[model samples]
Target chain A: MFLNLFLLLAAVLCAFQAIRARQMLAAALWLACTSAIVAWLLYALGAQEVAVIELSVGAGLVTILFVFGITIAGEEIQEVGSLVPWAVAGGIALALIGLVAWFVLPAQEASTAVSEPSFSVMVWENRGLDMLVQIGLIFAGVLGILGILAEKETAEEQARASQKTPTSTPPLPQPQVITTDAHQDTPIKEAHA
Target chain B: MSSELTITAVTVLCLLGVALYGLLIVRNLFQVIIALQILVKGALIALVLAGKISGQINLGQSLAVTVIVADTIVAVVGLALAVQVKRYTGSLDVKNLSTLRR
Candidate 1:
C-alpha cells in the first residue's frame, strides 16, 4: 500500500513538472518518469505486457524523441505566464472529465473478460493493419520534415538542372592588366618629374 | 476491500491527474512532452488497475502495450520534427512554430 502511494505521488509530481516546466527538455524528462511509474503500476497490477510496452515505448523511445527534438531545434524553452484563467479553465475541464469517467468507463470496461494474453494475437489480429498505417504516417511525417528543411539553394539547383535552359551570360573574364615596357617607362618618368 | 489495491489505485490516479494537469499548464514543449508521457503512464496504470479490480488478466496489458508502441513511434517522429523545426526556425518554443499550416 505504501509503495503504491509512493508511486502515485511520484507520478503526480512528475506529471506536474511535465506540465508546468518551462524547459521542453525538462518536460520530456518528467513525462518519461510518468511513463515509468505507469509501467510499474501495470506490472504491480499483473499486466506484464502493458508494463513492458509502457517501459519500452513510452518511457524509453518517446522520451528520447522529445530530448532529440529539444536538442535539434532550440535548446531553450521560454516561460509564459497566464495562470488564473488557465487554472479556471483546467479545473472545469477536469471536472468534466471526472464526471464522464465516473459515468462511462466502468460500464464500458465491465465486459472485459479473461482471455489468453497471446502476443501474436495482439500483434496480428484485426488491428495489425493499424500498426502499418501508423508506420506510414511516421514515414510521411519524416518526408514532410525533410522537405521543409531542405536548403533553398538545393531546391534552386534542382530547378535549374530540370529546366535545361542554359543562358549564355558568359562568366566574367578574369581581370587582366597588361603592363608593357612603355607603360612602365611613363610611370618611371612621372616619378622622376 | 484490499487496502493495497485501493491505496495503489487512488494514488496512481492522483498522480496521473497531476501529470495531466501539468501537461495542460506547462508552456514549454519539453515540459508538454513530459507531461504527455506522464498522462500516458497514468492512463496505462488506470487500465491495469481496472484489470486487477475485475480479475481480468491481459486485456488491459495489451492496450498498454499498444499505447507504448504508439508512443515510441510518435516520439521518434516528434523528435525528428522538432529538430527540423529548430533548424528552420532557430527556436524550440511551440509558440514560434506558426509555419505548420495544418
Candidate 2:
C-alpha cells in the first residue's frame, strides 16, 4: 500500500514537472517518466496487459514522437501569462472533481469480484472490431504523416529553387571619357549649356 | 469506502485536473499534445478502475488497450501537425496557427 502511494505520488510529481518545465526536451522526458509510473500503477491495479502497452507506447513511442517534434519545430520556452487563466482553469477542474465525487462516491459499493475471461479471449473475440478499427486508424495516421512530411519537403525544395535562381543585376554605369583636347571639352560644355 | 478505490479515484482526479489546467493555459503546440496525453492517461486509469469495480477486468483491460492504441495515433498525428505548423509559421506557438484561417 505504501509502495502504491509512493508510485502514485511520483507519477503526479512527474506530470507536474512535465507541464511546468521550460525546456521542451525536459518536459518530454518528464512526461515519459510519468507514463512509466502510470504503467506501474496500472500493473498494481491488476491491468497487466494495459500496463505493458502503456509502457511501450506511452513511455517509449510517445517520447520518441515528442523528441522528433521538438527537433523539427525547434523548442521555444513559452512565457507563462497571467494567473487569471490558471486560476479559472483550476476552479473549473475543482468543480469537475466535485461533480465526479458526488456521482461516484454514492456508487462505491458497486464493486464486485472480477470474473472475466482471459485477456486474449476478451480482446480477440469480444473486441475484434475495435482491433480492426485500430489497425485502420494506425494506417490512416501513417498516411497522414507521410503526406505532411512530403508537403514539407516540397516546400523546402521550392524555397531552395527560389534561392538558386539568378537575380537580375543592374547595368554597370558607363565610363566617362575625359578628352585631353580643349576643343572636345568646349563642345561638350556647349551642348550641356 | 474502500481505501484502494479512494486512492485511485483521487489520483485520477488530480491527473485530470493537472492536464486540464495545462491544456487551458499552454500556448505551445507540443505542450498541448503533452497535456492531452496526460488527460488520456487519467481516463485510461479510470477505465481500468471502473472495470475492476464492475468485476469485468478483461473488458476494462481491452478498452484500455484500445485507448492506448488510439492515443498513440493521436500523439503521432498531433506531432506531425505540429511539424507542419512549425514549417509554415516558423514557430511552435499556438497563436501563430490563427493565421492559417486567413
Candidate 3:
C-alpha cells in the first residue's frame, strides 16, 4: 500500500514536470516517466494486460513519436501566458470531477467471485467488435499521418524549386569601363551624354 | 471505500486537474498533445480502478487496451499535424494556426 502511494506520487510529479518543462524534449521524457509509473499502477490494480499495453504504447511508442515531432517541429520557447483564468477554470472543473467521483464511484459494490475467464477469452469473445474497430482506427491513423507528411514533403519541394529559379536564370551582366587617366573628362562626358 | 482505492482516486483527480490546467495554458501544439495524453492516462486508471471495485476486472482491462490503441493513434496523428503546422508556419505555437482563417 505504501509502495502504491509512492508510485502514484511519483507519477503525479512527473506529469507536473512534463506540463511545466520549458524544453520540449525534456517534457516528452517526463511524460514517458509518468506513463511508466501509470503502467505500474495499472499492474497493481490487477490489469496486467492493460499495464503491458500501456507500458509499450504509452511510454515507449508515444515518447518516440513525441521526440520525432519535436525534432521536426523544432522547439519554440515562448513566454507562458497568464495562468490566473485558466487556473480558476481548472480548479472548478476539478472540483466538479472530484464531487462526481466521490459520490458516484464508491456506490458500486465489489464482486466476490474468485474465478474469472482469461484475458484472451475476455477480449476475443466479449470485445470482438471493439477489436475490429481498433484495427480500422489504426489503419485510418496510418493513412492520415502519411497524407499529412506527404503534403509537407510536397510543400518543401515547391519551396526549394521556387528558391532555385532565380539562381538557375542568371541576371544579365553589365559592361565595365576602365579609365586610363583621372583627368579624362571627355570620355566621362561622352558616356554621360 | 478502501484506502488503496481512495489513493487511486486522488491520483486520478490530480492527473486530470494537471492535464486540464496544462491544456488551458499551453500554446505549443506538442504540449497540448501531451496534456491530452495525460488526461487520457487518468481516464485509463479510473476505468481500471472502477473495474476492480465493481468486480469486472477483465472487462476493464479489455476496455483499457482499446483505449491504449486509440490513444496511440491520437498521439501519432497529433504529432503528424504538429509537424505539418510547423513546416507551414515556421513555429509550433497554436496561435499561428489562426492564419488559416484567412
Candidate 4:
C-alpha cells in the first residue's frame, strides 16, 4: 500500500509538472514519467499483460511520438509562471477525483485474489481477435502516414524543383492546425485516396 | 495501507483529473496530446481493475490491449498531422491554424 501511494504521489508530481512546465519537451517528459509509473502500477495490480502494453506503447512509443511532435513543431519556450489559477483548479479537481475514486472502487477488489492465467492463453484464446485488429491498425497507420508524408515530400520536391534556387528552409515547426484529432482516428482514409 | 485496487483506482482518477485540467487550459498541442494519453491510461487502469474485481482478468487484458493499440495509432497519426501543420505554417502554436484548406 505504501508503495502504491508512493508511485501515485510520484505520478501526481509528474502530472503537476506536465501542466506547469514552460517547455513542451519538459511537459512531455513528465507525461512519460507518469506513464511509466502507471505501467508499474498495473504490474503490481496483477495485470502483467496490460502492464507490458502500457510500458511499451504508452511509456516508450508515445513518448517518442510526443518528442517527434514537439521537434516537428518547434516553438520558442515561453515563461510559464502566472498560471496560478490553473494550478489551483487542477489541485481541486485532483482532490475531488481522489474522493470519487475512493468511493467508486470497491473494497472487495483488494481481497479478491484470483490466480493469474498463462499469458499465452489470454492471447490465443480470448484476445486473438483484438490482437489481430491491433496489428492491422498499426499497419494501416504506418501506410497512411507514409502516404501523407510522401505526398508532402513530392509536393515539396515539385515546389523546390520549380524554383530557380533550392530553398526548402520553410519547414519550421509551427503547430498551425486545430484538426489533428479527427483524422487521427482514420489514418486509413489517406491510404484509400 | 489501502487495498491495491483502491490505490490503483485512486491513481487512475488522479491521472484523469490532471489530464482533464491540462486539456481544458493548456494550449500547447503536444501537451494536449499528453493529456489525452493520460485519459486513455485511466481507461486502461479501470479495465485492469474491473477485471480484477470481477475475476475476468483475461477479458480485461483484452480490452486494455485494444485500448493500447488504438491509443498508439492515434498518437502516431496525431503526430504526423502535427508535422504536416508545422510544415505548412512553419509554426507549432496551434493558434496559427484556422482552416482545413490552403
> Which number leads on DockQ?
3
For candidate 2, write residues B1-102 as lDDT tens digits.
477777887788889888988887788888889999999999999899888778787899999988998999999999999888887778878888887675
Kindly report which residue stretches of model 3 are placed more than 4 angstroms away from their true locations once superposed. Answer: A82-86, A114-116, A163-170, A173-193
| Position A124, candidate 3: lDDT | 94
True contacts kept of each: 0.55, 0.64, 0.69, 0.61
Candidate 4 lDDT at B14 equals 78
User: Model 2: per-residue lDDT, tens digit, A127-184?
Assistant: 9998999999999999998998888789889999978875697545555545578666
Candidate 1 lands at a TM-score of: 0.70
Per residue, candidate 3 scores C-alpha lDDT tens digits across A34-57 of: 999999999988898899889998
Superior candidate under TM-score, 3 versus 4: 3
Clashes of 2: 0
For model 4, residues A1-193, the per-residue Cα lDDT tens digits are 7998898899878877887687888887888898898898889888887888788878888888888777767854644432337768667777777777667765464355577566678777767887788889989999989988998999889888778564667544544334457747643322211
The segments of candidate 1 whose C-alpha lies over 4 angstroms from its true place after superposition are A82-86, A104-193, B99-102
Q: Interface RMSD in Å per candidate, to 1 decimal? A: 4.0, 1.8, 2.0, 3.3
Residue-wise C-alpha lDDT for candidate 3, range B1-102, written one tens digit per residue = 587888888888888888888887788889899999999999999889888887888988989888888999999999988887787778888888986554
- lDDT of residue A47 for candidate 4: 84
Chain A TM-score of candidate 1 vs. true chain A: 0.64
TM-score of candidate 2 to 2 decimals = 0.87
Q: What's the CA RMSD for each of the models?
A: 6.9, 7.7, 6.3, 14.8
**Rank ordering of all candidates by TM-score, starting from the highest:** 2, 3, 4, 1
The prediction achieving the highest TM-score against the true structure is: 2
Residue A160, candidate 3: alpha-carbon lDDT: 97
Mark the 10 consecutive residues where model 4 chain A has the least summed lDDT.
Answer: A184-193
For model 2, the stretches where C-alpha displacement exceeds 4 angstroms are A80-84, A109-114, A164-193
lDDT of 1 by residue, B4-101 (tens): 66666565556556655665555455555555555566566766666666656455555555666565555555566656556556665676678655
What DockQ values do the models have?
Answer: 0.44, 0.62, 0.64, 0.43
Candidate 1 local Cα displacement, residue A49, angstroms:
2.5
